[model samples]
Target: MSQFALLGKRRFAPFFLTQALGAFNDNAFRYALIGMATFRLGMSSQALSTYNNIALALFIAPFFLFSASAGQLAERMEKARLIRIVKAMEVAVMALASVAFMLASPGMLLAVLFLMGLQSTLFGPIKYSILPQTLHPSELVGGNGLVETGTSLSILLGSVAGNALMAVPHLGPQLASAAVIGVALAGYLASRAIPPSPATAPDLRFEWNPFVETWRVLGFTTRNRTVFNAILGISWFWFYGATLTVQLPLYTRNYLGGDASVLTLALALFSIGIGVGSLLCERLSGGKVEPGLVPLGAAGMTVFGIDLYFVRPHEALLREQNWWSMLSGAGGWHIAIDLVLIGMVSGFYIVPLFALVQERAERSQLSRIIAGTNIINSLFMVLAAAFGIVLLGVGLSVPQLFLTVAVMNAAVAVYIFTLVPEFPLRFFGWLLVNTLYRIRREGIDRIPEHGPALLVCNHVAFTDPLIVMACVRRPVRFVMYYRIYRLPLLRPLFRMAGAIPIAGAKEDPELLQQAYDAIDAALEAGEVVCLYPEGGLTADGEIAPFKPGISRVLERRPVPVVPMALRGLWGSVFSRRDNFLRRARLPRRFRARIELVVGAPVAPEGVDAAALEARVRELRGAEA
Candidate 1:
């Protein structure tokens, strides 16, 4: 289903609007405070900078201090009720903000900023952890996409509204203040429509100490290596975004020679790019959580960021210009495209990581894990600010800082991908399969979401494993002929995927037994194991008699066997049709339509080579 369809559902729509409104209000108030400090307060440049930094610090402090408590609250109480309470707090806080705006009290506004931060901290755990409960595994990516798109657009609109309204004649502060309060109230009304999200751990005790509880929450986040690394990836993204965003105003004024309106235009383009990228993830991933996109995103961000630095406008053009004038100027479009592409790649990088965390973390601890993520995110943002300050203190120009960040991004990406090779391995496989074929999967849901299942398929081509990997959402270990497994170019991918290499019993009895042992071990670890029952690719584009080795493997570890069939691949470049060498020299069938049909799983006791072969034959029909 289209991700937009989620907007019409009761389960998602109300929460989406509430969250959007809250985000809008937060940005609106923040931009208003910044505008006041800069233009209206008559403060000197250094004092204005100090106040701006203080405001940012205040907003981030609550995530560090209160995320643990907030996570526990969401776990201990009904989520919808908690949301309503948070929205009500927003309304009260905004009312106080209105008073401060009228009285021109900067201290009160700063306190209100801290209050807004506290509210967001309380809502963070509930926002993310509630997704898995409300969305199916298939819908997680799409759902996350919609939420991210909404957030980016909200931030854009709110920033525009706050700054634009506050610049009005005489009634500016009142108008901005009223706008925020109205948004807060609207958010409360939306929260009222959210269906109940019952607490996951209602009986759990709460810990009030921020230090100890923060440690506990972070520990929960580290329980799974992949999930914890995914969180780090997310936090790193925040660091990147925070550093760039903080520099934009100055970058516009000094580097690009653009006025405030041009800065707004740049930000708008970035926001729109993120929204587009986030929404596209659902379609790109085929409604599954595809972490492969994360690597693609990271690569794009590094490439585009480096290109941005090289393409920055020369200092000769550093004179203030309006939005349109800036766009029409030399090097303007390049800078704009770079910023937009960077934001788009950031969306691709972040959405999948969020979905992976949601799908992988233990349910009862999911809230705490998200809370931990927020704490880390806050830390990263703070560090990014400090890093930027130090770089600037060392006399690096804004464009130079961009170059440094791009280089740092590359280094960090390499480190992370090396630590978890699965991401890059999957990216390569995903890229190859997606580029080579238009794969259609039928009855894919018949495969279990979790647990050990033996998958038996009639392999039609040498690329069958890649095809299966592309179609199935779960990680699968494949058993392949040793020769194919050791193919020079494909060996690394095979090894990374942990494919078990098998030899004929007559050729190597020890290797055959070891292959069986590996299959059994994979099943014991609750992983999906797929193997071609015909032992090798079909020579005549027809199902061969299934080998009995499957039965032997199941004898040691009896598990459900799912039968699958591949169609429209028999004559492909990778298939052994019309002479393998001759076929390899022929034109590749790029983007060929292929179908993968999955059959109902048969219990181990009922599974036989002949029956499974018949089932696969039925699925394939005469397509081959």
Candidate 2:
């Protein structure tokens, strides 16, 4: 539970150190470039800002252009060796950066910046793709949190060190260059300590054309929808961060009437918030990679960002005030608080999504999928820049821009959940089932790893779907009645689960069409879709005639049909025969046995609706 335990092992420590140092050096070099442009070279503010913006643009650009290739490289090569090569490249780039600093050459500095971006792009796939390989599934969330927190902290420290050293007058360039080289050397040494990671795609042929290759990489998304959407979620976070991080300096100088030190305050506060939130992941997740936290984090980001926009910008500043002054609540502290909140929420938002992608992505294609993800992230960041430019051109102020971004985040989060409702709906069902049922699952291994599975179960209670979902490791889309799907209390819950709402044949033709389409899509996508074949809940604690819904879906897409039986929920409140007061007044320790017994998959050709129903009834009889 102690967060530091994440770094205590060989699996994590080396990679963590290497990544942390790289992040530190990245900021250090960027800061050094900014310093040389501004004070050392006697450039104007406008020129300095222009160079800084260009450096930012260059650094982020490779994520789009090279992410797919880098991801492929990660899949094809040994991660340990790849990291070593990457660190070596960093060393060479730092050497160029040293020369640029010594000569105070803007051209060389800009070129070195691009090299740094390229190095990061190459490292992107290996960086995240290696975690799932190295750590147990349980440790993934905590481990990612450590890396994120450390990276944020390193950036904060690196920026301070770079800017502070640059102010030393006599020792500025030497100190900055030395620091960059030192970090690079440390990263190289740490990378050497990394455990060897086997190649995911050893025989993968290298593609020469980036455009074509990038398009090919996207096909992986279609195969795994959850991983793909999680990738989108991650990219959206980058878009959100891009908008805020890029504007902070200008906001501090022009709006808050502060100098460089105030910018440091904003950065430090934000980084510290990330560290705090990241560390909390272990506790929040209860040591599991809980994707439920993703929505919560996204919600927080939007709410706090809006609050930040509304924060009154400080009109004046005391010159004597330093970093501590921002905390003193005299000038622009509201903006500082908003920054901290956003960073903290972002930490919570991102770590789980990354862990989910790693946990869900196929091991053989994880790196490639990660490569796909990096490309998307880069693309979104570009889109974010475009969005920012458009907003600015439309005469939006910094605060107003922040507000718009907050709204945009909310819209995007809803869109993602709508596209993949299982995350949120499952979370809802999970909460309810965990709270109400003491479920004991047996024969869980009977569920096939990859294939369509028909789950035939005895009617137990209205809450059966929730109980089944809670015990099953995978998400399930349940086929339920239109009325149940429209229950105001459970509508949000079902909506998220992507539940299929069916109408009786005589009720509505369009609803039936939608139901069949949803069921087909769910099974075709390799998801588990469950239905109560008895047509409705057992009103008299007896299984009814099996409905034809399961057979129809199975007929379309022949996969495994698993027959299940639930026992001992006949008199519960959720069951039909419950006497509300008596059931509520029942002793707390009811000592009931409720179970889900998974049977073998039914072959499509041999199974009919009646035959499947008979098998389910037999299982229920056996259990009873």
Candidate 3:
């Protein structure tokens, strides 16, 4: 089913609405203040700028102060009730906002903004933590995509509405105030319908000192090196996004010579691109959390961002252009497409990382992890603002600054990928499968999404493990024959993947023992391991007799064993069909149609070598 189908489900829709509305109100209120200060009060430009800076600082302060406490609150209570309470706080803040708008009290509005930020800080942890509870393992990427799409659009619409509404005459403030307050109430009503999400860490102690708890939660988030690195990636994205987006107004006005309507068009295109890209993730990943998309996305962001600088009009146009005027001009369309593609790739960049955090973080401390993420995000935003100031203050043009950040994105991607080699390795596998084969999966969901399980498959080609790893979503440690594992081209990838190389007792007794030890250790650590019990690839296009090595591994660790088969690969170039002299021939089955059929997991006790072999044969029958 499509991720859009989730919008109709009671389990997700209400919370989706509540979160989107909260986002809408927050942006609407903040932008309404900017509009009011800019147009209504007739303040000096310097004074308006100072007020804007103060407002931004006030809103961000709560995240630094209360995120850890908020995380604790989210963990200590049921998510539905906590969300409702946070919504109630928003309503109160909006009520104060209504009075402040009527009285035109800058101090009152600033205080209300601070309160809004506090509410958001409290809601932050629950926002993501509730997702894993409400969504199926297969639906995580789709769910996250939908939420991101809604948020990006909401923020865009809310800003437009707030600015338009507040820029009017005497009754403008009244309309903006009423609009935001109503949205808050509606958000509260929506929160009431959210299904209960039980607290993940109800029994855990929560520290009262914000600083100490902040340190502890951050520690928890970093314990898993991959998850922490993913968080860092996420934070960097915020920095990249904030830096790029904050420049849009100046970029549109000074460089493109566009009016407000044109800026709106630019924003719309970018946001819509994000929505499209976010929705596309489920289809691209086959309902799995595919981190491989990260490198692809990071590449697109840099490529398009750099292209944006080159395509921009060299000399700024003196007169402002409207939407139609720009579209009629050559320069306008290129810039628009660049923004949209950049936005789309950004969606590609973030959804997987968010899904990864949800998938990998310990269930009990998920809320704390989310809180840690929010803290880091806020910090990055602050840094991004400073980054922009430093660059622009140095007399660089907006496009030049954009060029710098785009190149920096590549550097950052390299650093992160170096830290987590799985990213690039998985990217290669995912890229290969998508580009080289039309793959159809059957019963692939039968394998568990989490916990320890042993997978046994017919070894078809050298790429068997890579194909399976790409499809299974979670990382799988493959056990391969020592010879194949030692192959020059494949060895580095295998070692990075933590694949275990095994040999028959006669071939190498010590190596065989070592492989068994590694397999047992992985199972005990709750990781998935795949074994090709055939010992080696078939010399002919047929299944090899199952070895008894699997039985010994089962005897030691006794985990659920899933039987799977690879079909339509026997005649491919990667198979024995290519003799050594003919190996350089063009792929016999280039872009071959392939299928992976998975059977229900077998309980270890009843699983002997022969029975599992029969299951795999049955799955592969009449196909390979």
| Candidate 1 lDDT tens digits, 291-312 | 8889999999899989988987
Q: Please, what is the TM-score per model?
A: 0.96, 0.79, 0.93
TM-score of predicted model 3? 0.93
lDDT of 1 at 209: 89
Highest TM-score: which candidate? 1
The 10-residue segment of model 3 with minimum total lDDT is 45-54
Residue-level error in angstroms, candidate 2, position 556:
11
- Misplaced by over 4 Å in model 2 are 1-6, 35-49, 286-289, 314-320, 331-333, 386-395, 427-449, 453-473, 481-483, 486-496, 500-525, 531-624
Q: lDDT scores for all predictions?
A: 0.86, 0.78, 0.86
RMSD of candidate 1 to the truth, in angstroms, is 1.9
Cα lDDT tens digits, model 3, 403-478, are 9999999999999998988888888999988777878998878998779999999987777887898898778998
**519 Cα displacement, candidate 3 (Å):** 2.3
Q: Give the TM-score comparing model 2 with the true structure, all chains together.
A: 0.79
